[model samples]
Target: MTSTVLTFAVSALTFVLVSLTPGDAARAVLGRDATPEQYRQLRAQLGLDEPLAVQYWHWLVRAVHGDLGTALSTGQPVLRTLEQRLGPSLSLITGALVVSALLGVGLGVLSAVRGGAVGRALDLLSMLGLALPSFWLGLVLVAAFAVALPIFPASGYVPLTDSPWEWLRSLALPVLTLGIGGSATIAKQTRDAMLDEMGRDYIVLLRARGLPERSIVLRHALKNAAVPVVTVLGLLFVGLLSGSVLAETVYVVPGLGSTAVTATQAHDIPLIQGVALCFTVIVITVNLLVELLYGRLDPRSRG
Candidate 1:
């Protein structure tokens, strides 16, 4: 019920905001120097001449039936446009999540287990990761790896079907750009959780029972600490979705983020609304999945 309300609210708000932005959809499509008659005809055909409430009502009806309308610029169905762009975005997001989880969990566990200089170093690195902007970091990576070293392509995506290896190579920099900050957050959370779990009486009981230190830390303490870390990961997924905009733009990834920029530039309301709606759905779905996962990890959360 809550999810349904949020979905409707976000969709309605997106529609209102996009409608309020100053631009004539017909004029944007027809361009300057179009005859007044041509503009009027196009406006009527596109239903732009109708009252705002009427326009929204019409759109809402069609959207309920899964018709997102046509993009003013491309004349293509918005759902089709989104389908074409969703793949690259998902690839970028999935790759970044993997990178963050492995790096963050590894660094965090190591820091907690071997405190002192290592822990301090991890702290400094996390701070740097959080401080640096993804786009700026992307540029630095491009210069070093793509320009200076010529190890990876600077900006562009390769379809996985064409060559799986090349596709992964292309996404490398963008993934790193989005993942670095996420890793920092996860690392901090994991470290704190691990520290707290290790200090608990249960951990002392396990040690007294002659459990191996490594087993106690990895199997017992880490499991108990996972609830919080998992929560951070769920939030990170949403952040990564938004952060992909900058990463995609910097790397020319041809994802929904880039398409959204193009749509906004051309005042493509249907396309813009479609993108916004798609993102909202994805975020809400991810959050729900996270909640389920959280309940699984910590059964107490189910209550």
Candidate 2:
């Protein structure tokens, strides 16, 4: 029920915001030299002459039926365009997510267990990760890995169907760029959670017993600390989606991020709304999964 409300609200807000932006669909399609008569006709044809409320109502109705309308720029269905672009974006996002989770959790555990210099270093790195712009980092990575060392392609995506190895190679830099910040964030959260868990009464009890230090930290403390860590990871998923725009643009990956940039540049309202709606849905779905995982990890959450 909450998810439904959020989805509806996000869709409506996206439409309203896009509608409020400068320029209309007709002008975007007709160009600057179009005469008054042509502009009027185009406006009528595209229903841009209608009230904003009526326009939103009509769009909402169609969207409910899976018809996201046509892109003013390409004259193709918005859903079709999204489908064509979603694969690359998903690949990039998935790779980044995996990289962030592994790196973040590992660093976090290490820092929490072995404090002192390691913890301070993680704090500094996390600050840098959060401060650095994804696009700037992407550029640095490209220069070092692609230009200086010539280890990977600087731009462009290769479909996994064509060559899985090439696809992974192409995504490697963008993933690192997008994932690094998220990993830093998760590492901080995991470290805090681990520290808290380590200081709990149960931890002392386990230490007092004959349990191995490795088993206590990994099997018990880590498991107990997982809920909050999972929550941070879920939130980071949304950040990753937003950051993909910069990462994809810098890397020239033919993904939804690039498509979104193109749509916004052309004032493609339908395409923009479609992309926003897709992102909102993805975020909500990931959060829901996180909640379910939370319940699984801590049965108390099920209540």
Candidate 3:
């Protein structure tokens, strides 16, 4: 119910904001020197001369009917353009999540279980990750891996259908940039949750009753601590997905993020609106999934 209201609100607000932004769409397309007559005709042809309420109503109806209209800049169907770019964005985000999960959970468990030099080192690394900007990290990685080592390509995206290896290679730096930052967040949350779980009376009782330390930490503590970790993971995934704007721009990836940037720059109202709607939908969907996962993780919350 809330999601439905949010969707409509976002659509209306996005259209209003984009319409209000300083710039003439006609001039954007036809150039600054276009005469007033040309601008007037272009506005009429594009239906921009219509009343705001009427234009919004028409757009809402068309959107409901799965017709998102066309991009003012490229004249391509907004939905089709988004569809074509979806694959790369999903691939990049999924890779980042996987990388973050592995490194984060592993280091978190180690730091919680073993408190010594190794733990301190991991803590320091995570702090660095949290402090560094993804774009800066991306540039550094490009310099070292792409330029100095000449191992991975600095920028450019390859479709997975063409070759999985090539696609993964092209995505390596961007994924690392996003993943490293995400890992810090996940790792800290995991560590804190584990520490809290470990201090519970049940854990001490298990240890006193002759449970193996390994079993206590992995089978008992980790399972019970997972609820919070799951929460952080869900939020991190959404953040990374949204944060792809920087990654896509830096890597020259033709994903939704870069497309949104391009649309805004060109004053492509329909394209921008479509992108905004898609983002809101994705966020709502992820939140719903997270709620379901939370219920499963903590049976006490099922009621």
Candidate 4:
């Protein structure tokens, strides 16, 4: 209940901030010859002339009933636009997160177990990944896969319902960009958490009791280490909420990030507010779920 209200408050705040940016669709559509009188008229016509409090109240009421209002740029409903573009963006992020979780946790396990040359290499790689920007990484992946190898499309989106192969082809580079960056962040967190778990006296006692190494690490270490891993994941997801803007732009995927860029460029208040609110809600909801998962994943976390 707290989180639900929290989400609403944060999302409401996002609406106000995006709506406050200077200019509007009228300014973008009309030249400077667009007089102050003309601007006021246009704002009134769009109902954008209202005070922020009034605008926010009406928007909040409408959004609760699923009417997200219309984009100022195209005068199209925001929900309709989101529906068309959400699938590819969601698919890309979901696939990347899954793959990253597996590889990252696996590498982290190895790093915790070996503590040798392999561990050093994994740690080093994680650091590099942490430093690397996703947009730059996307460009590099495109150059390699599309430019040189010609294996994947350099940019574009394909609907999953249209063709599975097309979807995969279009999603590969964006996935790699996200996965590489995400996994690196997760790997470091996992490595550190696992290392801490292994140092616990119970783990030492388990080793003394002749528990199989695999059972000890997988069953014991991982279960205990998961809380922190989940924390990092929540943080990473928050990062992804905003970071995806560049990734989406680079890949030409019609996600909210691209929508945001267009909305901002065109000074489309409705679209901008809608996207910001949706993204904030998503990130907050993800974090809330992670919090619940921690209560389940780590028994001691309840304390």
lDDT of 2 by residue, 1-303 (tens): 987898889888988888887767788778899999999998888888899889889888999998999998899999999998999999999889999999899888988998999888977787688788887888899999999999999998999999999998999999999898788888889899999999999989998998998999999999999999899888888888888898788888988889999888777878988998899889988988998999989999999
Our model 4 lands, by Cα RMSD against the true structure, at 2.3
Pairs in clash, predicted candidate 1: none
Report lDDT (CA) for all predictions.
Answer: 0.90, 0.89, 0.89, 0.84
> Cα deviation in Å at residue 215, candidate 2?
1.6
Ranking by lDDT: 1, 3, 2, 4
Kindly list the per-residue Cα lDDT of model 3 for residues 27-118, writing each as its tens digit.
79999888999999998988889997888898999999999998888989999998998888888888999899888888888888886998
Better of 1 and 3 by TM-score: 1
Q: Where in model 4 is the C-alpha error above 4 Å?
A: 30-41
- On residues 10-69, what C-alpha lDDT tens digit does candidate 1 reach at each position? 888987888888777788888999999999999899888899889888888999999999
When 1 and 4 are scored with TM-score, the better candidate is 1
Count steric clashes of candidate 2. 0
RMSD for each of the candidates: 1.2, 1.5, 1.4, 2.3
How does model 4 score by TM-score?
Answer: 0.90
Regions more than 4 Å wrong, model 3: none
**Candidate 1, after superposition: displacement of residue 98 in Å?**
1.5
Q: Candidate 4 residues 13-87, lDDT tens each?
A: 777666667766788866678889888888788877778789888878898898989987887999888877677
